[model samples]
Target chain A: MARIIGGLTSSHIPAIGNAIARNLFEDPYWKPFFDGFPPIRAWLDEKQPDVAIVIYNDHGLNFFLDKMPTFAIGAAPEYRNDDEGWGIPTLPSFAGDPRLSWHIIEQLVGEEFDVCSCQEMTVDHGFTVPMQLFWDDWQKKPIRTVPISINTVQHPIPSPARCYKFGQALGRAIASYPSDQKVVILGTGGLSHQLDGQRAGFINKPFDLMCMDKIVSDPELLARYTAHDLVREAGAQGAEFILWLAMRGALQGHVQKLHGNYHVPISNTGAGTMLLENAD
Target chain B: MSTEAITQDIPGTIIFNGEQAMKGYALNKMCYSFNKADSRAAFKRDEEAYMEQFHLNAQQKAAIRARNVLDLLAAGGNIYYLAKFAGIFGLSVQDVGAQQTGMTVEAFKAMLAKQGE
Candidate 1:
């Protein structure tokens, strides 16, 4: 009975948080990034989904080099705002919906997906940055969340095929939920940008556009892409595109682009945003 | 190494080999129960009784039963495996710290300082 309102994909740069906190939206460089996200902002205001299932990769913040999870889902009542070394000027902790999260977990598992469920999980900039951009006064809202933590930081990460399958499982699970509440699936991470070692500051606008095109029309081809392909084209860090596939797959091959935008050189990364509504 | 050799060899290292990895059905079952509304309550009422159904080894069981992050890492578990265990413990690596040393964040910092002494 559950309905997916739509999907939102965005880049999560820590610098964007700094800019927002300092009220530097008018700054020339940051302005383009903010402008690109207007569609997401409008979608959030108009759709107002009951819960947002966010797929993101945590960067050495919640899970470090010591241990990581290829995929972990949050089933907690509330999640505190993390201090990723540098603090977010004045943002409060985010609230979570444990009941709905548990339901989704149960449904997904029933549909035959290997899921890691956590009761007390802290979200890093990957999640908070996107939330800050999409919501108005996110800290104060009663937002329920199902945080899907992807392992993009470490080697031998999930394959594009696997991520897409997980997304399909997620769609099946959400559809199986007995509630009639509306759900929004947000895929946060990248669209061609890399950070780390010599490959830092790589951006492929052609590949980014191609990714957008495939996410909506030719997802089957996207699923066949190996991590090596994404790495070679979009750079290693750009491999976070796997997270976006999960969102695309969840729509079960039904997607309509609401808006799309791309900009580069934001704190040494290419940033982009895309809004998709379920056509099925 | 040539691309073909590297590509073929990669799977053997990460993915479980032989029969160990053939748990697609079991994985699905676990996923289903995990997502259920009464997952926490069900897990709490009879965790051992529930896990017994999995037919995992002592090492696997111990990893899942681990109370913190230290226990998980010390068990020679990978991130995905550790994640399943961490989920059961309701703990994160940030909370548990390194297991072999049993050092808190501050304690670890202190130990580093002692090296300077």
Candidate 2:
């Protein structure tokens, strides 16, 4: 049976893509944010998880308003990235575990999650940025991936508690798979920052700190926040905190916080990065 | 659910719920097309003709014409879609936020930086 090694979280804002492209890590303005990744990369190198499940929100790339799926999973053999109109350089395609994806999909639907499974999906920065952060030169050392997209762009997104439950279902599905593969779950996006309306530059550092702390100790408290409550406290886009909750849910065993870094104003976001190790 | 119940009252924010989605469909569809380089070029060639193709209403057209972020939101524009439109003119979220809040780019950035302290 497959074993879940741990879970990771990173803010997947598009500016991080541009920053990586420009090789701006050492630049003073970017160093604090860029500095967060070395420890994560070192851990990945040591553990070397074979497959990664990325939980992220599609920002108008793969699915638009015409037909938005509340919860979608990628079951393709390979997933590709495309230009999201900011002219950011698109990354190379990522290999997918179709067999494992089908297994998880079957299990999830059986569990009554009713997720949309996609054979073809265009992953945006939300899925790609974290991969870049965790594994530099991902092209040379590739990891098979599965992308789970939650609708955060449009309103009426899934509640935090519901997402946590979905994560728990996902954990069971992965553990039940008949494979020797090791897996890592990545919850990408947000601490707090809004980019719309007159409240565009909103950032709540205190709330963000409370979240990062509680997500490790008491995710139930974080999960208790309604979507509206999250939007009010974490800003509109900051509601992506649910993604982190979903990642947390997948770690059913004893968990420990390995490392964490929080930085402000990364392309109008309160950037957060955390790595949690699981021990059964 | 009642309309008032579904529609949140987050200050300076508009929830892009079903009502806003329905209202902004045409405008958003137009912006979503900007994902393709050729579509962006087509819109650049003739903005008026492009808006016509998307069947954008007067309010949406005016919002696009004015390049006002607040007005665009008032016309039911979701920021994600409007971002593609904003990209045409090389505007980042900071630029839009500055414009909407009536602050210079530096001031808006300063406000964001101060949050960390």
Candidate 3:
């Protein structure tokens, strides 16, 4: 049976992608944020997985208001990055594991998740930034991916409890895959930062820390958070924290958080990253 | 299960739910077109024509014409899509944020720095 090796969670702020593009690491404003990723790069080098299940949101790139899917899974053979209307450097296309994807889709639908199976999808920063953070040169195509997208953009977003439940279903699907491939589940988006309204530059590091603690040790408590509570506490755009619940739900009980990091103002976000290894 | 729970009246923020999604579909579709260089140029060439093509409501047209970020938000323009509109005027989201908060751009940057401290 396929095994879930672990889950990784990180903030997918697009400005970080822009900084990477402009080679801004040596710049003083960026060094602190850039400093956190080298350890992640080294860790991934040690615990390389065959495939990565990337859970991220589409930031007006692939899906628009015309039709939005609350949950979408990439079932294509290859996935590409879109130009996010800001000239952020586009990464190479990601190879998809169709067999694994279809298996998960079958499993999810069987369990009543009703995730939209996407045959073709162009990912935005939410998908690319985390990959870039972990892989020194992600363009080498070292791993295949299944991009799982959830809607935090449109209102009526999935609640934290529902997201965690969906993650648990996802964990079951991954464990039951016919092959022995080792897989990594990644969730990318937020740790308390909003992008709109009169309260635009909102950041709640305390709340973000509260979330990280809950997500690592007591995800169900985090799940108790209503979407309204997330917006109120984590900020409007920071509702992207819902993605982390899905990641937290995917693993078995008591996974050890191997490493973690959090920083603020990564261009209107309190950026955070965490690595959790299943204690199996 | 219904629109009843959406917090649209959360003070100064306009929540973009299914209702707003339908209202701004054409405007957002036009903004999404900015993903390509050609469309950005097409927009820059004839702003009025582009708004006309999108069948933007008078409010949306006025918001676009005046480059008013708050007005756009009230008119159902999602922040991500509005970023494209802001980009044309060389405005970063933080700049837009400053505009929303009624602060000068430099003050917003300083506040962000202070927040980090």
Candidate 4:
């Protein structure tokens, strides 16, 4: 049997990586942002989860503008790091657990989730940005991952209800896995802020706080929201936050808030991070 | 000239151009088609009827009806969605890549290798 040891939600601005790689944490604007992530770092250090089911969206990197799957899962033994033009400074390839990944794949299929499974896939900053913050020496570790890639960048993406249901299904799949491993479900992307023409720098603190509340106490209400509504309120790209509900829905109702940090104007987007322990 | 450019002047067909290329209506249809089990059947039963539901313009409808990947891309159609449409033609993204770039997939791979150097 598997238990969700905890859940983490983080903003994945590529600039954060730039800050880390350049050792610019002491810079006035970047220091607080870097400081905000320590609680998540400490939690991962302590929990040491055996597997991490990372829920994230690809940004026209691996999937490309050619064909995008609504929900794709990476069941490979390892994932290669993608070079999104300028490469990640010192990051190494991510090691994945094939046996556990395959088990979850089988369960998702049995549950009729209709996941797109791949053996040799490359992950972009969507997965790595959070990994860099959560785990120390993550690149060198022998950690296994189950990647759930959502179609966020493209239009006609999965509905919020669909995402929440998928999260519930993933939770069931994880719980039913034969292995006795501790798992951590990471939901990455957004607290608020939108990136696009005219409405480029939009950030709604009230809506973001309301979303945080809905994610924990009332996911059902959040599920009713269309992607259009999120884009309008939080900015177009802000809808990526829907991925968080999948991780939240998979956890126990009550969550222990470990640490949280919120910041704005990071490369034309508002960003935030939150760590939560599942109620046992 | 590219096959797309040649086809753009074809009579009674839509010419995809400029911002219309990124509008994503065709891409949305491609996702909807492949994700739904009965999509192929529905399209086969009545292609125009099925497409009409999207409320696409005359040009979008014509481009989709023509099954033109280049036209779609030119009309602001996303490659991701176009890839799905290519799948319907028993084509892979590599094939579409070759078609769009006017080079063989192998040639493109070699080009990429060179750029990586």
Count clashing residue pairs per candidate.
6, 0, 0, 10
Stretches of candidate 2 above 4 Å error? none
Per-residue CA lDDT of candidate 2, range A119-193, in tens? 999999999999899988789989999999999999789999999999999999999999999999999999898
When summed lDDT is taken over every stretch of 10 residues in candidate 2 chain A, the lowest stretch is A83-92
Tens-digit lDDT string for candidate 2 (B1-117): 887566668898898998889988999999999998999999889999999999999999999999988888888899999999999888988898899889999999999999988
lDDT of 1 at A131: 82
What are the per-residue Cα lDDT tens digits for candidate 4 across A47-164?
Answer: 8888888899886456754467888899787787644433345367777888777777788788887888888788877888888888857766666788889988665677788889
Ranking by TM-score: 2, 3, 4, 1
Q: Against the unseen true structure, what C-alpha lDDT does each candidate score?
A: 0.68, 0.93, 0.85, 0.69
Across all models, the iRMS values in order are: 13.4, 0.8, 1.4, 14.9
Residue A229 miss distance in model 1 (angstroms): 1.5
Q: Residue B82 of model 3: what lDDT?
A: 80
Q: Pick the candidate with the highest lDDT.
A: 2
> Could you give candidate 1's per-residue lDDT for residues A130-204 as a string of tens digits?
888888566566667788899886567789999998898889888878888788898998876543222333467
For model 4, chain A alone compared with the true chain A gives a TM-score of 0.94
Q: How far off is residue A231 in model 4, in Å?
A: 1.0
Off by over 4 Å in 1: A88-90, B2-117
Which candidate gets the maximum TM-score versus the true structure?
2
Model 4 misplacement above 4 A:
B1-117
